[model samples]
Target: MGVTRLVSRRRQDPGTKWARIAMAVLATVGVIDTGSITLKRWGFLGELTCPMGADGCDKVLNSSWGTLINGIPLSLVGLIAYISILLMTLMPLLPGLQENKADLSRRTWWGLFTLSTSMAAFSAVLLGLAVLKIQAFCFFCVLSASLSILLLVLSIVGGGWEDSGILAFRGVLLATVVLLGSLIWISAVDSGRSANVGEKVGVPPAVTNESSIAALALAEHLAVGGAVMYSAYWCPHCHEQKELFGKQASQQLIVVECATDGQNNQADLCRSKRLEGFPSWEINGEIDSGVKPLSILADLSGYQGSREF
Candidate 1:
């Protein structure tokens, strides 16, 4: 009777119960999302959509950040992380599980979950860059961001620290510190990826090329310097503009899509920027409607380039 009572008391630590379970559920979903992204990158999926338009999906997918070192999909890494976290959190429930449980854990679960949180946050930030800085969006990137936010919430809610002993608390506290320390690292690595690629980057350059510049002589009355294209994934006209640049050249143009429900969705962002229309352009920094030929756009901006637009 005495042994049973002691064992039950030891087993029912409050924080471990709820926090661990929540972590498993949220982390597991994150795994699935990340796993799919990895699989997609392996050429296993074969169809990556371009955030600007569907034309450049393959190009961006094949670009850098599509795979991890040694060709591992970053999504695969998320899967493994989620699976490991699930196992660690549920370990206390295993039959004779504590036999493997150390009296003072390095707090491996806490440390790992904390790491996962940081990675998720970093990924979400990069996704924003993919949209804003790069001016393109990845559907898979959105899915991953959602998963990360979900897991972070789970971790906070599942933590049973008040009921945990000093050792567990200390481990958690340390893990929190480590996660914070990594923010600078995430920011540094993520910014560059955000800056390059996508139509947003290509916009000015596309409008600046030769034939378009010559055409600008005709459109010079518009006083257009900067033109923005509001686009949607389903817009056929946007596809036409992207095609004008051919595959490689098109990706370099900066295109801002305005589809609220777009897979590369930036609902609040588009709203905040007051972006409207598919393949909409802001000529001379003033919003203009419809897809204009490259030459016409150049005239609006007074472009001077030797290359044929």
Candidate 2:
């Protein structure tokens, strides 16, 4: 066979083995992220409330980031990617056709390459937006980011690295498309429409009686209540927390980044703080986890902000 013909081989390279392990980890992350969001959205997980003691899960989920492109939950997207990674990584375990071994390897390589490259680039952008643009954290979002980062590493070290040149080039082209699309769409859209930079809109604060931007800024410093929020940038609920605080207010409270990639990284504080879940809160140091209603949260925290809890 000509060297250029790409030889018949198995994807079970030593590196592929490691990549498999990494994909397993990302898969687990997806499961955790999706599971949490499901519970929160369904009201099965409502242990924590906001400073106003309001429930804002639905509010945030209904927002933009919760879904991708047209209408796909970010969790579903991660689930698909991780599942794809799992399948591609485990391709070796599949029974090979009597005469299509080389074709199989090439196909698997191309698939894995495509999946990993797109996911990695997307994660990078989401993470950047989470901190610099949105200035908020979502445990699930960060979890996905970490998983994507791992997948990217696995793709590179895995045997697919050799086969990924074409995919990588394509990935760059696609990334350019995405970036340009975002720039164009954003430019065409309302500049005041909020650029994923978490900010306040809609209703004004009923509690503090002051929704002024300055008041919102002061609220952050006053304390975010005894709440432990487990969040990832990719998580809509976490963004809900930011929305509640009005972008500027969300920056004041202490946050934990459970996502291993340090997506928002309130300084590796989650582990040190023994944070157990995303969007979890410790009201007066008492643990009340998950997306919660502002009213209920206020009651729990003894909200004295002039808002009924």
Tell me each candidate's TM-score. 0.46, 0.51
Looking at model 2, residue 102 earns an lDDT score of 52
Q: List per-prediction Cα lDDT, in the order shown.
A: 0.53, 0.55
Tell me how far candidate 2 lies from the true structure as C-alpha RMSD in angstroms: 10.4
- For 1-309, candidate 2 gives per-residue lDDT tens digits of 646543224444665656666666676666666655655555567533323312233323434555555444565666666777777656654676526645665666567656776776777666665555444555556667777767666655564444446545676887676667655543443353345433433321222222445435334434745355555543455666656665455656565555443344553565465543457776666765566656566567565554421
Error of 1 at 169 (Å): 12
Instruction: Quote model 2's TM-score.
Output: 0.51
What candidate 2 gets wrong by more than 4 Å, as runs, is 1-12, 42-63, 68-72, 95-102, 160-168, 182-309
User: Which model scores highest in lDDT?
Assistant: 2
Error of 1 at 151 (Å): 2.2
Task: Give lDDT tens digits, candidate 1, residues 126-160.
Answer: 57556654455566566666766666665544443
